[model samples]
Target chain A: MNSLMAIFRFELNRILTPGRVFWWVVVAAFPVVIMLLMMNYLQPPRGATQENINTFFTIALYFVAPTVSCMLGALLIAAPAVASELEQHSWTYLAVRPNGLFHLVLGKYLVAVVWAASATIVGVTVAVAVAGIEDPGDAQELNQDDTVVAATDDRAVRRGGRFPGETATDVVPGIVATGEVGRAMVGLAILSACSYSALYIMLGTLFHRRAMVLCVAYTAAVELFLGFFPAVINRLTIQYRLRTLLFDWTTQSDEFRNSGVLDFVSSDESAFMQVLWLVSWTAVFLAIALVSVHVREFTSASETDV
Target chain B: MTSEYLIELDHVTKLYGTVIGVNDFNAQLKPGAYGLLGPNGAGKSTLLNLLIGQLVPTRGTVRVLGQSPRNNSAFMKKIGFCPGFEGLYATTTGLDWVTLLLQLHGVRSRPARARAADCLALVGMSNDMNRPIATYSRGMRQRIKLAQSMAHEPTLLFLDEPFSGLDPVGRTEMTNVLNDWIGLGNSLIIASHVLHEIEALTDSFLLICGGRLLASGTASEVNELLFDSPSEIEVDCSEPYRLASVLMDRELAVSISVEQKSHGGDTVRLRTLRAGQLWSQLPDLITRNGFTVTRVRSADDSLQTLFNSLLKIHRGEI
Candidate 1:
């Protein structure tokens, strides 16, 4: 435990350099910049209801904050955890200590997750604040005749109890509740950080020589490419689990279902089940990373030639 | 009771694909200071890696402190290793880097900092400990590497090419630090291709070549081998023929030849089995004959030449 904390603290200190902090600022401000541009150039129509604007900003937040910001942040931090050590010829020093490899991997994973999560959560909150959430009573007054309200009411009646979206609005009776949207996006950001950091750490351990390239390839192929198809394989990805949780928490499932684009999500699974899957995948990736670091021979480049 | 031997390797062989790294090596080393002397590509680094648990043997076993080094954390805690390569972080200060490594050994932050400071100071790095390592010279980097390795005060320390980038004064400082370390009664195994560097630290040596152990002996034993081996000597002189004739008559030269130089005088080159005798008698012969000798140089006195002689002896060629 002491070794793990030592590694964690040391790595965190190393990550806070001027250059790295600049890049982190760029990551956190990305969604806010995009949201500002979208609100300026792509204003809602004159007759469009506040619900439509809320849904648009919510989806934008999901894609930019949890997906882009979190993925990029985690990738930059975690994908080079072992490769950096090896390139610098510093692995032998750390590998000789008791539980060194295990602590190193876990410690770097924690730092990556914290750094990525903070960036995404801050990005989501700033974007939400910039886009502006209307008062709940005013939004409800304007959304009284909207079809989304009717659909939400129908689903609530069918489910025989209040769903997450309805319960989220008990204090504010509107579709675009600031507290609910911010909470859900922040939760997904944390999940996205944990899951992606673990996956990238595993890649870093297994293919340390080409860790960053392999991680980028895996993210592009498996997470982005395969995540689009409405197949069983898509169900196996963290993207699918995170997206399902997003729709469930934000009450956006009915809208996607009506549009026939909900085929990729396992709607049959509850939000709890989706969280369980994400957590389980994180555990599996972390386990593989720890085991790989333990058993693999990570000699210096010169020694490898010998 | 503690184990009798600090390290034991039994028929250890490490193969990188088809190339042999350490070829069926065997050794049982007691706890003391020893040097691993070899030319480049002689598998000294490979053997060090094997003993430090960075590489596992393909055919045999390695035991350190009576325990297998492979994945043996308890054994790892008792050993420290400083690799031959430059492993310092460029952007980090020397103090921070060493302290962090100590922390990895389960030392608390406060004590780790204090110990790192002391070790750095011992290596003559106290004044520059707070500077970024990127600003350090090659010798300074080497000193910092040594500091981190010994900061934890392990029971055993393994150093590979510890004198690679040191200047004369830096080498003296490093030798002093290592001598002090040995004075503490801790075991040390240092690998280097330079003979004098190892000689400055320890008398015992394990000579390796072509991934095989050629011989193991003390400094005096190695000197005896040098004395017995046939050595070539060249004398630049005004009277090459006279010097060659005198050397032959004195029975110091097994073979002698005099060659005409392009400039002032001729040069006399001779092969002798008794170089010490030749050196001792040459001045008297020169004084008696009044020969104008300018320079006397030994042709084969390098470590590579020594290893070649040992290899020849190992093959029964001498």
Candidate 2:
């Protein structure tokens, strides 16, 4: 336990370097920057309904929060966990210790997950604040007939949940509700960060030179493509599980189901089961990383050859 | 009790694909200081890696501290290894790197910090420990590398080419630190190609060539292997013909030849099976004949001969 904590502190110090921190900051604020540009420059219709604004927030959470921000943050931090050490010729020093490799992998895994999660959460919070929910329409129109459906039938609502496009007074409360959903999305973002970071850490351990290439390929094929695949293999990915949990937890299954975006993501898995699967995936990847560190020979002479 | 040997290798051979890194090596090291002497590519690094448990042998066994080193954490805890390569965090301070290493060895916050400071001081880098390692000179980097390995105070130390790039002063400082470490009664096995550097550190030596152990004993044992054949000596003299005629009748001179020097002078070259005996005669011959000699060279006293003969023997050539 002491060794793990020491390695944790050591890895934290490594991650906090200026070069690494710069990338971390860039990834964390990316989602907010996009939202800011969209709001200020693109200028959504001045008369846009509160439902339209909520839809925008949901879209940002999907691409910006989890997909872009959390992913880049995790990839930059975790994908080089072992590879950087190998390049620097520092692995022999750490590996010679008792339980050194195990502690190092676990410590680095924790640092990557926590660092990426923090950045993603910070970005989500800032983006949420900057992109506050626009006021819903008149209170008397709470029972408005077709305008609510018409107002909420955009891409964002189609991808996520139905927006309550009622009274302008309901705007604040509805916006507050959306904020709650956004918070849930942030939680999912953290979960996905840990899962992805764990896998990348394993890749770093197994293939020092090709880890980043493997990571990019895996992200493209498995997470991006296979995630939208709607097959049993798709279920094996963290993206599928995270998306399933996202809709299930936020009570947006019906909304996205009524629309068509949830078709490929259709799964009846409970939130508990999805979380269990995601956590299990993290554990399995970490185990593989530990075994690789134990089995592989990282000679200090390798640095000279380079 | 565990095996008394600090390190034991039994018919160990390491092959990287078809290429052999170390071949048919065997040794049993006790608790003491020993020097690993070999030219480059003679398997010094490979043997060190095997002893530290960084690489498992392809054929045989390697045990350090009576335990197999491969993933043997308990055994590793008792050993400290400083590899021949520069493996440092360039952006971090030397103090930070050493402290982290100590902490990784299970030292707590304050104590690890203190030990790191002390080890750095011992390596003569206390003043510059706070500076980033990238800015450090080659000698400073070597000192810091040594400090990190010593910070944990392991029982057995394995250093590979630790003196590679140090200046004379820095080398002396490092050798002193290592001598002090030996004074503590802890064992150390240091690998280097420099004979005098190894002599400065330890009298015991292990000579390897072509990935095989050629000899292992005291300094004089290695010398005996070099002098096993008749040694050739060349004398550049003003009266080379007279010296040659005189040496021809001497029992110690197995063969004698007189020839003109390449530049312009005469030279008398002799091969003596008994160099020591001939050495006594040379002084008497020079003084009695009132000969003026420009240079006396021992041609066969080169390390190349020993290495060449060892490799040839390994190949059954001689």
Candidate 3:
């Protein structure tokens, strides 16, 4: 326990260098910067209703919350945690301590999760605040001829479309709350941040020199490609589970179905089960990372010459 | 493995793929101070790594403190290792590095900080302890490495090439500190290619070459291995001719060369197979000739000669 805490503190101090903090701040504000640009320059064609604003906010959350802020932030911080130590020839000194390798991995894992989650939260909060300022709730009704066109991924735009099934007198209105969406986005960001951090840390331990390369390949193969496929393999990815949970937790499902685009993927799983799947994946990958560090050889010669 | 020895390696071998790091090595080191003498690429670093449990032997067993060193926390707790490479967080200060290492050894934060300060001071690094390691010179970095190892005060310490980057004064200071540590009855195994530096630290040594142990004994005993080769001695005297005549007459000298000194004396270098015989007969030779012997120095009494002789002996050449 003492060794774990000491290594945890040490890893945190080592990572909180001045240059690293600057890059993190820049990454965290990227989502907010994009939102500001769209609000001022794009303007949604002038006759846009509150439903269009809600669609824009939902699309923004899909991109910035999970894809950009969470994934990129976790990759930048966690992918090099162990690889950097090996490259700098500092692994041997720490490896001699009792259970030092285990503590080192755990400590760095914690730092990456906390850092990435916080950055994503900051970015999401700013984007949601800007979304409200752009289209405050005065116009919640959609015109019959108004087409809700969104960013790339036709499925995502279909998911972000306005609902047509709700009457004006319905107690639960058709209008999406930006703050509510932000809360759900926050939960997704935290879960994805942890899951990505765990997976990348495992990759780092498995392929010390080529960790980043493997990470890129994994993202392209699993998260980006298989995650969107309407098959059983898609369920293996955290993206699939996160998307399922997002629809279940918020009013987005009712809005998306009424928008007239049907999803083949099953949304029958409870929010609790999807969250459990994500947590389980995190645990399994973290366990692999810990076990790899313990069993692998990280000599100075292996790191430098070979 | 026996409990009497702090470190035991029985026919241990470490192979890095087809390359041999340590070849059929065998040694049992008791609790004391000893130098690991070898040149570069002599497997000193590899052997030290094995001893510290960083690398496991391929074919044999290694035990420290009567237990296996591979992931043996109990054994590691009583041991400290300072590697040959510069293994430090470049952005951190010396104090921070040492304190973190101390805390990893299970010391609390407050005590680790105090112990780190004391160890840095012991290595003569108190003034610059707070500076980032990136700004430190090669010598200061070596000192900080040593400081981190010593901060925890282990029962046994393994230091590889500890005197590599030290200047003369710094070497002297480090030597004094190591001597004090030994004076306290803790064991130390210091590795260095330079024989004189090892000679300055400890009287006992282990001579290794090509991943094998060549010899192990006291300084005098190792030097005695060079007796088969002609020992070179330099003599400064007032009567060079007379001294040469006496040495030649007794047949005590195998070869001799004389150079006329500009300061009204002669300098003669003599090579004799039997230095002991010549030394026993030196007083009579000098007194009989009434020669004023200002200096008598042995040229073959160096580590390089001892190592050369040890290698030859290992090959059965002498």
Candidate 4:
């Protein structure tokens, strides 16, 4: 217990110094600034209604949040825990210490988890606050439209020929049943942050020296190709689970949202399935994280010959 | 292994594939200061790693404090180590690194901080304790690594090339600090290639060559194995030809020769064995003979010479 805590504190303080904190703030701000810029150009000129404003906010949370969180986790946690140590050649010193390797991994993981979750919360909070003012009680709707409107997989076609507009009676009842979108957004934020944290920690642990490169490849694999599939495929993707939890939080729209077009790491599946898959898979990776932290040979035995 | 000895190695051999690390090594280090003497790649590092349970052996049992070193958790707190690399977290100050390492072994933060201070003081690094290691010089960094290991107050210490990079003054300072450590009842295993460094701290030495234990004991014990065979003695005399002509009958002086000095002077150097044997039979030769003897030195007997002789003898025997 003492060994673990000592290593934990060392790992934590090593990465959370003032300089690192400043860099992290910049990385977290990138998505928010971009989201706001895009939303401004797309917002209707005079005023926006419930439908358009909710749709914009949904796009921000679904598309912007995951990219920011995962990248931040990798840079701050995975990079430091594994890559920085290798570059510093501190692994040689750690190898002989009684329990230095385990401490390093734990410290980086815990700090990254906290940092990722907090970034998501702050981003989502700002986006939600701005959206709520523009369109109050806009996201509580459940089903968007009864009529098959588009003759396409993209929308819930309605009795009318065109996409449902703001104040369209078809969307009001659906909003009333599902409640607002932000509450569910927060929960998905927490779960997705934790899952990504576990995933990065595992990746870092498995490949000691090149953990950063390996993690980048993994993020691209899981978050891009597999991340685009619908509910069922999303069940197998990290973003899907988080997105499913936020499905009800999304603005009720007559037309379907290509979540990836508006979202990422988001799923069309039920929130319950999303939670089950993300949390359970995350739990297994968490085990990998723990064992990797414990058993990793921090330093290579190959003594360099100069 | 016997319990009286703090560490005992019996026919220990470590091999990584076909390359030998330690070949059929045997040693017993009692609870006192002992220097491991060897050159680079001479297996001293491997031996220390094995002693601390950092490594497992291929064919030998190494016992530390009378228990197997491999995964022996209890003995860990009793052992301290300062590796040759001297690597520390640059972001963390010396105090932080030392405190954290101690905390891992169950020391509380408050006490660890205090102990870290004391340890830094011991290594003459207290003033620089708050500075990050990145700002430290090579010697200062070494001092911090030393402080971390000593902060634990371990019973057994393994310092690999602790004095390697130290300047002469730094080496002297470290030698003094090491004296303080062993001035108490603790034992230390210091590895170094400098023969004088080992001679300064320990009389018992383990001389390694080509990954094998060539000799293990006091200097004189090793010397005995090297020079136990009779040695030749040379004497510069005024009448070398006359003395050489009469000395052929001496039993022990199997070979005798007289050579004029390189300057082509009258002086002749007499090579003989058991000069006393010749003196006993020709008592008058010492006092009445017109012979002024000038030179007497070992035929092959400086420490370096004896060390070489030991290696040669082993090479021939094996």
Candidate 5:
């Protein structure tokens, strides 16, 4: 445990340089910048309903904060954990210590997760605050078409048998309240960071020479492609669990929930089950990474020459 | 492997694919100081790596402190290795780097910091310990590497080319530190190609060439090997021809050649198998013949020549 904390503290200090701090700021500002741009240029028409605006913010926040920001942060930090040490020829110094390899892997993995999660959480919070939620009074005025209001009311009732004004604080003009969605997005962002960091760290240990390339390929083929395939394999993806949790936590409209477009997300699993699955998969990846680092031989190019 | 020996390698061979790294090497090093002397690519680094458990032997076993070194944490705690190459993190300060390494050995933060300071000071890096390593010179970097290796106070230390970047004064300082280390009853195996560098620290040597142990003994023993080998001596003299005749008459030389010098003199170069006998009889022969010898020097006094002779002996050539 002491060695693990030592590695963690050392790596944290090593990465807090000016160059790394600049990149981290870029990652954290990404979602906020996109949200500001969208709100300015893609605003709803003068008489447009509130459902369109809410959907835009919800989907945009989900993709930008939880998906892109977290994925990029984890990829940049975790995928090169072992490769950087090898390239710098510093592995021999640490490898000679007692349980050094194991602690090194675990400590770096934790730093990656924490760093990526913090960036995503900050990005999501700032984006949500800047793209302010729509007031129900303004929605009632802009949504002038009586047919659209009745349809929204029916959808809200189907969602949880609660009208918009019946419980004004609990229900927003759209499917769920802004506070509930913001909390759920933050939770999902953290989970995304943990899961992706674990996967990339495992890849780093298994393929030190080509870890980044292999991680990108895995994300493209398995996580992004197979995640939306509407097959049994989709359940094996982190994206599917995250999407399921999002839907379960916010209680989306029944029509959208039953729609065949998002058939990849499992409706049967509860939110707790999805969280358990994600945590279990993270543990498995971390276990494989620790084992690989412990058993495999890693020598620098010069050492190999000797 | 018995606990009596600090390190034991029994017929150990390490093969990097078809290339041999260390060939069928066998040694039982007791607790003491010894030098690993060899030319470049002579398996000195490879032998150190094997001893530190970085690489496993292909066909034999290696034991350090009476236990297998491969993945042996307890054994790791007892040994420290300073590699030939510089492997420092460029962003961290010398003190923090050493302290962090000590922490990896299970020392707490406060005590690790104090120990790191002391080790850095031992290497004469007290003032510059807070500077980032990127700002350090080659010699300072070498000192920091040495400090990290001994910070945990291991029972045995393996240093490969530790004086590679040190100037004369720095070299002397590091030699004193190492001598002090040995004086404390710690075992050391310092690897270097320079004969005098090793000679300054310890007389015991493990001579290697072509990934094999060619010889192992004290400096005098190596000198004895040189004395027994066929060697050449060049003598600048006033009467080279007469000296050559006298040397041949006494059978002190196997072959002798005289060359005319540009300065109106001659130099007699003689190859002798019995160098000890030649040296003993040369002054008397020159005095009796009234030969005026200006200068005399041996051509086979370097470590390379000694290694060549040992290699020949290993190959059954002489």
Candidate 6:
């Protein structure tokens, strides 16, 4: 429809404004340094059979996706979500024309998704390609050896991923590639970015100016906190659900899957069941966001009252 | 082009729970110029919002261009409104703002751009087209607000205090633009407390008080109910001495006295519009052949009486 296209064009033009573009460039370009580092001289041990390149790419995204998506999508939607229009006194300018509550909510929601998706795609793709090109040594010890616990000193990079050791360095630590399963790892990084964007956009609508506080407290106390707990909270935290969707986990013995990580939740339930949980929670949050948009009065603070 | 009345409200009343916005209001409006004259906090803004279908009434129905205005696109297209406050996109350029408005009204491409330019020119702000509204002065902002309202050629205009915060020059320009807008058989409903400003724009008025319809008619009709109290009349007598002597003995007349002043020799001023009783007997004392006389005017035809009578009626002691 022309109206939908007009709304999309208007929203895209708004995001491409100078101030927003400058910030997007910064967020999109942060993982390029990691890519450059990996391309320098990190070849695998001579004569070591190289696994598929896709695993390394998934390993790369594990680092950049979490940081970039949180800052870009979670924090970015705060402005266009609800408060910016109030500051501009643009209600009459917007409401007079028939961009009713539904259109307004839909337009902003779509922009937030596209914005986060663009930033996340860059970080994920570059990290994936760069990780695939570079190689790490000691394949048997890293992938299969039993008593070889991950060393702490070189492991301080601590980027989360599909693997068990330093063989991967994108942003988050530990991307492991077993056998010939590479493409599934790439799919995992993308799923992480999308799920995170959806959750935060819903939060942005629910809490207008206080979005940062909610995200920080939720990320720290709930997500990181629950990830540490031995209980089944992985079904709720975004990080856990994202990790559950990425790696092809069979039993609970994989290094990244050991004990209190995402594996504990996966220890009992199948990967498909965990994905269902992620989707159900996403639906719940989206429903809350729609209600928030409908109830919150779109009054401008500067010149309008009551 | 719809030939029927653009807006019609029948006993529309709105209450914010206990506090009332507009109470028992009824109006039949055709396509012409109309002024909604009322003091501050007089519910002028409330009535305007109801007409636009932004707020629903508790009691009666309001029909704009024959359909209920609530989400009625066909009716909304014919009515353009500038609310009590300046609702502008502070970041948008003046030209782009109007163009967007016209485009939303289904004006496409180059013609929308051309019409936007013409609208800015009519509001006397073509030079400031590139500037963001955030940087504009109050008068310039008001002009842009008007340009957006009229850009789409709406048939019914609802302007709530459009002349507020305008300098004398800006006021004249805005009034002229609105007057010209209504010249093409279009209608305007404007609200203002400035009597002189309202007087210049339209003679018909709606006086609102305590969320009630206090008075509605031509300006003079409301004025007559407000100020004309004493039964006084001006007489052009043929014989000054004889005519002056005749009016001295009336009981209802307040000290029936005659004073001579300006204009050719002697003149008398009286304070009444009920001149029929005085003219019947005044010819008895004076002969027209002695001196041919000319003018007769009501001394109490002042706005002060209308204002006082309005206040009295508001207090419920009248």
Among these predictions, the greatest TM-score belongs to 5
Off by over 4 Å in 2: A37-56, A134-176, A253-255, A260-263, A300-306, B232-270, B273-318
List the candidate 1 regions with Cα displacement exceeding 4 Å. A43-49, A135-175, A253-260, B222-253, B256-270, B273-305, B312-318
Residue-level lDDT of model 1, residues B1-318, one tens digit each, is: 156998898999988778888999999888899999887888999999999888889898988888888777898788888889987888889999999889988899999999999999999999999999999999999999999889989889999998889999999999999999999999899999888898788878899877788877675567566776777888998888878787878789999888887776778889997777888888898999999889988876655567777877777787
What's chain A's TM-score in each predicted model? Answer: 0.85, 0.81, 0.81, 0.70, 0.84, 0.67
Question: What TM-score, computed on C-alpha atoms, does each candidate reach?
Answer: 0.84, 0.84, 0.85, 0.76, 0.86, 0.72
lDDT of 3 by residue, B1-318 (tens): 249997789999988888787889999888889899887877888888888887878889988878888777787788888887896888899998998888888889999999999999999999999999999999999899888777788888999888879899999999998889889989999888888888887888999988899888886886666655557889998888778888888899978899887877788899897777777788887887799999998877777778877777677776
To one decimal place, how large is model 3's interface RMSD in Å?
A: 2.6
- Return whichever of 4 and 5 wins on lDDT: 5
Write down the TM-score of model 5's second chain.
Answer: 0.84
lDDT of 4 by residue, A1-306 (tens): 676667766766666778867766665665566655654454332333346445545655556665555456544575446666666666545544555555556656667766776776676666554333322232222224322122331222231112434333333211111136556655666776777777877777677567777777777776666776543565576765565565555554554464344354454556667677877887887688667654543333443210
- Candidate 6 lDDT over B154-247, as tens digits, reads 8888887888778999999888888877778788888776667776778777777666777877866775554434445565644555545545
Q: Looking at model 2 chain B, which ten-residue stretch has the lowest summed lDDT? A: B300-309
TM-score of 4: 0.76
CA lDDT, candidate 4, residue A266 = 53
Looking at chain B only, the TM-scores across the models are 0.80, 0.81, 0.87, 0.79, 0.84, 0.81
Worst 10 residues of 1 chain B by lDDT: B219-228
Instruction: Arrange candidates, best TM-score first.
Output: 5, 3, 2, 1, 4, 6
- Residue A20 error for model 2, in Å? 2.5
Residue pairs clashing in model 3 are none
What is candidate 1's DockQ? Answer: 0.46
Which ranges in model 6 have alpha carbons more than 4 Å from their true place? A1-68, A71-74, A78-80, A100-102, A123-133, A137-243, A248-253, A258-306, B1-5, B220-308
Candidate 6 lDDT by residue in tens digits, A1-306: 333444445666667778887777666666655655654544533222223223343444544565444345545753346556545556555555643444555556566666766665565555544444212344223444322234433332223222343343323222344222234434543454445555665776666667657766666677667754667665567666655555443122233344344446333556787667667776776667667655444432223222
